[model samples]
Target chain A: MTDISRDDVQHLAQLSSLALSDQEVDNLRIDIGNILGYINQLSELDTTGVEPTYQVTDLENVWREDKIDDYGLGRDDLLALAPESKDGQIKVPKVL
Target chain B: MTKISDYISKNARQNVLEAIKRANDKNEYHALLSFTEARALERADAVDRGEITGRLAGVPFVVKDNFFAFGAPTTAASRMLEHFQAPLQATAVEKLEAEGAICIGKANLDAFAHGGSTENSAFGPTLNAFDKTKVAGGSSGGSAVVTALDIVPFALGSDTGGSIRQPASFNGVVGVKPTYGTVSRYGVVAMASSTDTIGCFATDAADAELIMDIMAGKDNKDMTTLPDFFKPTNVKPGLKIGLIKETTTDDVDPEVKQATLDYVARLKAAGHQVDEVTMPISKYALAIYYIVVPAEVSSNLARYDGIRYGHRAEGVATLAELYGKSRDEGFVAENKRRIMIGSYVLSSGFFDAYYLQAQKVRTLLINEFNKLFEDYDVLLGPTTPTPAFGLGENTADPIKMYLADIMTVPASLAGLPAISVPVGKSSNGLPIGVQLVGQRRSDADLLALAKSMEKA
Candidate 1:
């Protein structure tokens, strides 16, 4: 079994940009640990010299014209989806 | 057992109204999230006035809530997007609309298309269409149930792993997961982009075929989409099919195995050659999927950091707090579990061991499939190891829940086209499904074969 510590879970949460509660961190510690243990079974396979498959489509570097097509959605329409907007731009908490 | 033809002969308004009424009647199942009544009625009136006409011609349908459609908010069954409306319709939805298909409502799903059952839905679990005590297999659970209940002839679903196929199996419907890139993913909520494919659920294979034919095409908006290679073909005679030996082992439920063999027998009656073929690497597919998918999922979900759209947390002083708190509030437990797992695997020290190793193993798994396809036109297996499990039966243990996808994930990891067709029921009376997997670009053939054997 994977010995995923509470701190390990917290570090993962930080990496994932998630502010987990003490209870969540405790629960996820066990849950994520079990998941890792299950997925670790992949190591049993002998994949020596096997090339990794990143994407299934044989197509590569599919280039398209740089023409901007918003599919009929206008700026206001997109801005309308944002949680907060001001002065025709998205508003966010002040970045340090 | 509704069909596209049922609505084709009726006025668009009548079809749309009837579908809406059925959806409301079956509300206890929690298959639907919200109705697009106003937009549907307006579109129905247009079709009645002869302004809209096509093959589907006013046939009503439902989309899994993950899709961006007009009338309702496109929540991916999560609190994050609960009230978030899509700026544009998904290309798949647009294509269906072009064929005069009216979308009456959005169906429920596992939050962010994660988990094997709709039990993970943030709103609530969608009840199985067959027995409310059992779960609706997911994350396409709601779409499958709506079709099974005959609320609509067909519905759209996206399959990243076993989302569409497993649910369709549980609900006794036809589900299609086209070869990777068969349909554009644009306007659909992205989940593990490498494996995500837009597909549909239907009462029968023919409706699934027509829906796939219409939605299968290239879109400049999504570069991963293949140049439309899907052309429906009649099943070739005396086809050689491989019944995967790994899937029918003693560990699988006896009823599920019997149903799969029964389907194979029907193939034999139709003069197709069925052989038990070995693919040992199939055992490791779920492990590889768990690693690679979550890694991709973590990256894909990073876009939901609360600044641009979706949910936001108030009372956060710093930008980091805003990002963290909002995400913590917006996402459900399963979402967090996947994201953290993804983070752990993709982090610097573990990247090579977990993520890269899984990818290499994935290649090995696909190679085994390719080798088998050389002798077999298609591979057959049970869609799930068992029938629909009781609600919350495996929810407490995440690994137990993940095992439900063991049979279907191999085809998904290989980016192959696979379909699940309802065969028979277990002694306990739960529906069982047999899955047919074809090589990439053989989406049309897979459906054709399933369609031909529909009666049997």
Candidate 2:
């Protein structure tokens, strides 16, 4: 079984953009280990030449008319859903 | 069963009012999060006054909270979207409303439809309709319970893995997880992009078929939707049925196995042929599902970064802290576990070993199902390994909780339509369901087979 360390858990939390607490990281360390061990059973399958099945709609490069489609959603309505909005734009933390 | 016609025949106002009362009375079960009483009553009055006219006029239903509808926020039982009012309603809800079906309330679910049990819900777990001690199997537990409790004749739910089917089994209702693209996913909380399907739970097979028919069709908003193909038909005799060898193993609860076997016997008695078929890759389907689904989940859920809608962190100066803290606060433990696992599998070094390999095995699983479909019109099995378990039984172990979906994920991976039909009760009086899996686009025929059994 693959044992996930606290550091490993932290790394994953960082990757997922989740600021997990020490207790949460501790809990996830064990749970992630068990889940990884469970899914590790897939290593036995020999899928050498098999192609990956991504989307299953059975359609290829479905295209629509090259035009703007608002889907009946107005800009002001969507912008209003944000936590903070400026003049026609969403406000965010300053990035250096 | 309170059929749709029953609601239409009765005074629309009284029908909806009584249903809302019954649902409110069953508050201990926690089947519904909030009632859309004002909207529902308004629509009921309109229907009574002949303002609205359609197939499902005056019928009341419930939507799992993941779907966007008016009157209540689409919480998905998560703190993130707990107060996020939907700007638009799900296409499925719109369709039902177009047919005059009134959505009376929003049902509870596992946070973002993450766990098999609604224990992962931020608010609280929905109790089983039969026994309060046992879990109402989820992530669509509330929909199943509402239907089982007769609060509504039918309720809408979204099934990614076995969310609808497993919960239906636990609560003893007919639940359909239609072909992946049969219903549009627009305005529905995204889980796993590839497998998320819109379906419903109903008291009977004919009602299930009616609900599915209304919900199935293409929508331009969701590009993944398939063309309209669902049509109800009489069950044709002499259909070839495959009894899956994997689901009836000794490890499965004896009662569940027996329920499946009893359903098989009924199938034979109804002049259908049954044969044991082996799809060896089904043994590995759970493993492949965990990898592929989480990868999709991680990608899909990335949208909840405290930027647009939903929850945001308080007093965080830096952008990084804001994103991180808001997400950590918003998501339940299961959501983080899945996202982290997805990050690991889809990470640079492990991509080929985990994500790509799982996808490859997925293709193989689909191939095995295709080969088996050549011989059988439908495949039969136990919907779950066991009956509804105690509320806290599997919550401690994520792996144990995942085992609840082992028998149902193969169909999801292959994008096939499957349904859970309540067969009988276990020794303890808990419901036992037998699953019917059909080939792609064979959803109508599958419902017909279950309906034929009901008539018999």
Candidate 3:
């Protein structure tokens, strides 16, 4: 099994956009290690000529009309449900 | 005595009002999170007045809270969306309503559909129908309990690995996980997209089929949905049935194994040939499932940042702190565990070693299932290895909980249709269920075969 470390966990948190706490990071280090160890058993399988099954639905390139269809809900109606909104736009905390 | 149609035809408002009252009087099982009494009555009145008419006209049903329905907050038994009212209805809910099925309430589930037992629900655990102390097997625990209690004739549930089938088996009810794309998944909270399916729990296969008939179809919203091919069929005469040898292991609970064997005997007596078959790759199903599922969950749940919706933490000035604290607060321990595991496997250097490898393993599992289907009309096994355990039995250990899904995950990973039909009860009086798995587009045939077994 590939060894997972604190830095590895921190880097994953960044990739996943999760801001984990120090304690959480430490906890994840152990938990992730256990999980990886379990899944690593797959490496023993002889998948020599096996093709990966990605999407289950065999349907392909299901085309639809290129026309824009209105969902009928108005902007103000949708904006009304937003937890934080300003000037008819959804508001988020400022990011650098 | 009220047949399903009779209850459905009676004034929608009064029917739901009485059903809610009956559910409240029991108090033996805490199956519902909240009752949409006012909204249900309003919709029921519309159906009675001819303002609404369809297959489910005025029929009352409950949805596992993971589904986004108006009138009630869609809390997937997580604090994350506890107070978060959905801005819109799930595509599945909207379709059911279009047929006049009034959603009376939202049922409980494991937080983010994580655990095998509903003990992980943020609100509280749902009790099993037969024995109040035992768990309502989850993560669709409340949906199964509500149906078993006869509060509603049916309830909708989302099954990822074994959420619907395991619970239905535990509760002595019919649980169906239609072919993966049979029902739309536009608004149901994503748990593991590759295997996630919306299905239902009902007292009998007929009622389950009625609900499936209404909900099965393609939608512009869910592109993955297959063109509707779900027409109920009669069981073919002299069918070939395969009893999976691996699922009927000595390690499985004796009662569960006996129930399955007895079911096979009955099928044979009815003239369908029952023979033992082995799928060696079946042993590796859970390993592949845990890897691939968490990977997808990590991606799907990333949308729940503290910004747009869901819970936001306080005293966090920095944007990063806000996200960290909010997710840490909103999610339960299992959700965090899964998200972290997902992150670890999908990390830059480990992606091919873990995530990609798991997908390749999944292909082998599917190939084994496909090869078996070519020789057998359908595969039969126990829905769960054992009957429902006590509420806190496997809570502390995550791998133990994952093992409960061993038999059900292969069908899920293959995207085939499967069902759990009540066979008998254990000596302790807990219910036991048998699973019937069929080819990708053979959902109706599987249900028919299950119905024939019911007659036997």
Candidate 4:
């Protein structure tokens, strides 16, 4: 059985850029450990010389016109979806 | 009476009203997030006035809220996009609208389509159509319930890992997960990119075919869409069918296996050969799905930072805090579970061990399916290991919740077309659906085979 420590959970949250609470981290430490243990069963099978599939479409070199097409949405329409906007620009919290 | 043909003959406004009224009637089920009554009425009036006339004229339907349609906000049943109304409709929804289908409501789902059960929905869980105490199989639970309850003839859903099919199985409805790229994914919330396909839920296979015919085709907006290849065909008998030996093991419920065997017998009585076949790699497919899906999800969900559309943190002075807090608050527990697992697999140290290994095994799975399809026309299995469990049955353990997807995920990892069709019921009276998985573009053929079962 693989045991994921609290520190590992915290580090993973950092890598994922998620700010997990103390309770969340504690719960996830156990759950992620169980999941990783389950997934580790994949090592049982040998995948010698097998090619990895990234996407299933089997198509390559997909090219389209390099021109700008907004797909029919106006600037205001997009801005309306944001929480804060000013001067025709989306507003975010001040960066340190 | 709510079938597409029935709606075609009825006054459009009346049909829309009846569905909305039914939605109101079944409010406790929490199937629909928002009923677009006003918009539906307006569209229905247009169809009645002869301004809108198409194959599915005035047929009211529902969409899983992940679809970026205009009538309501596409919550994706997540707090992140709770208020983030879409600027444009999904291409699949647009095609359905062009056929004069009026979308009256947005259905519930697992937040970001994460969990197998709707318990992860930020709103609330949708009770099963059969027993209120049981779960509505998810993340397409609401779509399945609305169809089973006859609120609408059909509804749209996205199947990433049997999100459409399993729920349809639980609710005794028809769910289709078309071959990857069979329908355009534009404007739909992205989950696992390689396996996510837009499909529908309906009361019968023929209605599903009509909806698939309208939605299936190439879309310039979504480059992966195949050139229109879907055509309705009457079921042709004498095709070779294989019963997956792996799915009928001791771990599966007896009633579920009996239902599948009963369906296989029906196929045989109708003059087709049925035999047990083995695909050993499927036992590892679920593990591979967890690894590959989380990797894709972590990357796909990376776009939901606070900067653009979606929820933003209320009190964060730094940009990193803003992103971290908003994401931490927006995603549900299972979503975070998958994301962090994704981070673990894709991280530099673990890359070769986890992600790369899973991908290689994925190829083996696809090859196994390919080899099986070389001899068999389609493969059959129980859509789920068991019938619908209670709402809180698998919620405590994320792995337990994921087990609901095991029988359904092997076909998904292969990017094949599969459907869940209701065969019989459990002794407890819950619905059971048998799955038919076909080769990559043989979607219409699979549906035809399932439809033929009705005649049998």
Error of 1 at B438 (Å): 0.5
Candidate 3: stretches off by over 4 Å: A1-11, A19-27, A94-96, B1-3
Q: How would you encode candidate 2's per-residue C-alpha lDDT over B100-206 as one tens digit per residue?
A: 89999999999999999899999999999999999999999999999999999999999999999999999999999999899999999999999999999998999
Q: Which runs of model 1 end up more than 4 angstroms from their true locations?
A: none
Output the lDDT of residue B202, model 1: 91
What CAPRI grade goes to candidate 3?
medium
Give interface RMSD for all predictions: 1.0, 1.2, 1.9, 0.9
Residue B25 miss distance in model 2 (angstroms): 0.9
- What DockQ score does model 4 reach against the true complex? 0.83
Query: Which stretches in model 4 have alpha-carbon errors above 4 Å?
Result: none
TM-score, model 3 to reference: 0.96
- Kindly provide the TM-score of model 4 when superposed on the true structure, using C-alpha atoms: 0.99
Per-model C-alpha lDDT, please? Answer: 0.93, 0.92, 0.87, 0.92
Model 1 lDDT tens row, A29-54? 89988888898888777778999999
DockQ of each: 0.86, 0.76, 0.57, 0.83
In lDDT terms, how accurate is model 2?
0.92
**Candidate 3 Cα RMSD after full superposition onto the native fold (Å):** 1.9
B348-378, model 3: which lDDT tens digit per residue?
A: 7778877888889989888888888888999
Can you list the residue pairs that collide in candidate 1? none
Q: Evaluated on chain B only, what is the TM-score of candidate 2?
A: 0.99
Model 3 residue B121 CA deviation (Å) reads 1.6
- lDDT score, residue B125, model 4? 94
